[model samples]
Target: MEDISIISMLLTAVFVLGCLYLVIIPFFKDETFLDHTRKSHTNGATKEALLTTLNEIEFEYKMEKLSESDYRQLKKQYESQVAKLMRDEETSTEKAIDRDLLAEVEREIEASIQQKSKKGGGK
Candidate 1:
């Protein structure tokens, strides 16, 4: 009876350890069951994510998981969002270029002024 109790205790400890490993291992490894089954929307989806979602929508439509109307609406919405994002990015880039150009021109003007002052003073 003591031997049976010892074996049961050992089994219980092993079972608890196994359960802990199953739960804790993923935490240490930076993974989880949801990682495989769901998309990460934490940082706001990127252009690539939008493209992926579009593809997924198409696939779902083909599989009849989405209706034709739903697919069309979703596709349109994603395309619009992508277009707007691209436009915003382009505008920001243009503004940055303009700022850089202005800074360069200011530096050139300052250098020209310095040279003129030096030449005039030296004379």
Candidate 2:
């Protein structure tokens, strides 16, 4: 009896842990689910890196280490890339805001319906 009870307890614990792994783990592990903050951090890092490289190129040119043509070419490329990143970041932010607004609207609609149903039922 003691051995059976121990085995049953162990099996229950394993089942619970398996259930948590299947259900709860995905919420924590899903990188794209609610990751606006991470996106902004990545954008900041990319912007900073581009600016740093551009400055380095300028410094090199000032030191006469880079030819004028090469300096201008690199500067133009980095600036364009930076512009694209900024545009993409803005778009992503807008999308996130839209999603939040939609969710809020849905909740309000649901609440209004529930309230109407309750009032109707009470009458």
Candidate 3:
């Protein structure tokens, strides 16, 4: 009876530990996951808003609601902002790709070194 109780308690503890691990591991694995998601979402929303405003400005200008100078200035400003956001997004994407490629290359180099040492040692 005592042995049975101890085994049951051990199983219970293991189950609790497993549950805690599943719940807690993701937070540690990528602490910036939420931040990255929010930043991308905000950038997308801002870009969309700017595009919409640009369209509205064009429509207003066509309807003669804005002076020619004002319309040109607004169009230029919004176009510059949109261009900047696109450039920033592209740079970040390139950086992430570069990091991943670098990590893979490092892993391959390490693996090659290990294989060479193993073969040399066997001889």
Candidate 4:
């Protein structure tokens, strides 16, 4: 009876440990796989979604479903988000334009140098 009880207690401990390992292992593993599968929405898609949400909020407020203060607060938050998105889009556009201009300038400089070299070599 003593030996059986000891064996049973050891088995219970092992089972508990196994359960804990199953629960705790995820916390220790790399979470990049989750990120890899979860792609973020593009700026256009996100802007459209926000606009739709804003329209819905306006309709709800008109229907008297939301309090005036709540409507104002929500409107402010969504408007800020939209503004930030617009700013990000504009910044990205400006950076692209800058890069194109720089590339054009570099090409022009290279062409001028090559032309001078050819003229000097011929002389």
Candidate 5:
């Protein structure tokens, strides 16, 4: 009975240590993970003023403030955001082009009808 009690105590200690490790490791890991993910999701930029945050990143990179791996990783992230921004910009411009074409077609049809009416009235 004493041997069984000692074994149970050791098992309980091991289980408690394992639980503590499981809880602590994840809390530390989450900080870095969340920061990287937040930097990745910045693909949304506005138009009309053209803001690019890459230069500041480069400056930090050149100053040796950031590690090589981090600089490369962050540069890649900014490039992706820029690509997404450009795609959205292109989409907006294409929509605008389509709108102008539609307006021009409407104006041309109205002009033709006006000319036809004038000719009929004159006759």
Candidate 6:
């Protein structure tokens, strides 16, 4: 399949999932994949944007623009986003560790090959 079609289908699946999550899941639940990236700080962007959004959220709460329940709910959302960013950071760290381990194994194998060749076992 074409790349665009793959992406379209993936997005459609995500939309369906988001609708279901919004409809059925209770508050304080996990977010979807798209939400994870939208909430990601992997780009090294200053957390200034997030802090700004949170300031706005706090203002809304303080000004009585948000009901107590709504304020709590949105605060949960922002907190969840921060949690997701941390999780993403942990995931990348884990991935880098795995890659380092793989490279070590590859280097060992290459050294073994060179040793064999030096011993005149190479064709």
In terms of lDDT, the best-performing candidate is 3
lDDT, candidate 2, residue 86? 87
Quote each prediction's TM-score. 0.54, 0.54, 0.67, 0.61, 0.50, 0.42
- The alpha-carbon RMSD values of the candidates against the true structure, listed in the order shown, are 10.5, 9.2, 9.8, 7.8, 15.6, 15.1
Clashing pairs in 1: none
- On TM-score, the candidate that comes out on top is 3
Question: Over all chains combined, what TM-score does candidate 1 have?
Answer: 0.54
TM-score of 2: 0.54
lDDT of 6: 0.80
Candidate 6 colliding pairs: none
- Model 1 weakest lDDT span, ten residues long: 36-45
Q: Per-residue lDDT tens digits of candidate 4, residues 1-123? A: 999999999999999999999999999999886754453346678999999999999999999999999999999999999999989879978999999999999999999999999999999
Each prediction's number of clashing residue pairs: 0, 0, 0, 0, 0, 0
> Residue 43 lDDT in model 3?
100
Candidate 1 stretches greater than 4 Å from native: 1-44
Q: Any runs in candidate 2 off by more than 4 Å, and if so which?
A: 1-44
Q: Model 3 residue 23 lDDT? A: 100
Candidate 5 residue-wise lDDT at 122: 100
* Ranking of candidates on lDDT, top first: 3, 2, 4, 1, 6, 5
Sum up the clashes in candidate 3.
0
Candidate 5 similarity to native, TM-score: 0.50
lDDT of each: 0.86, 0.94, 0.97, 0.92, 0.78, 0.80
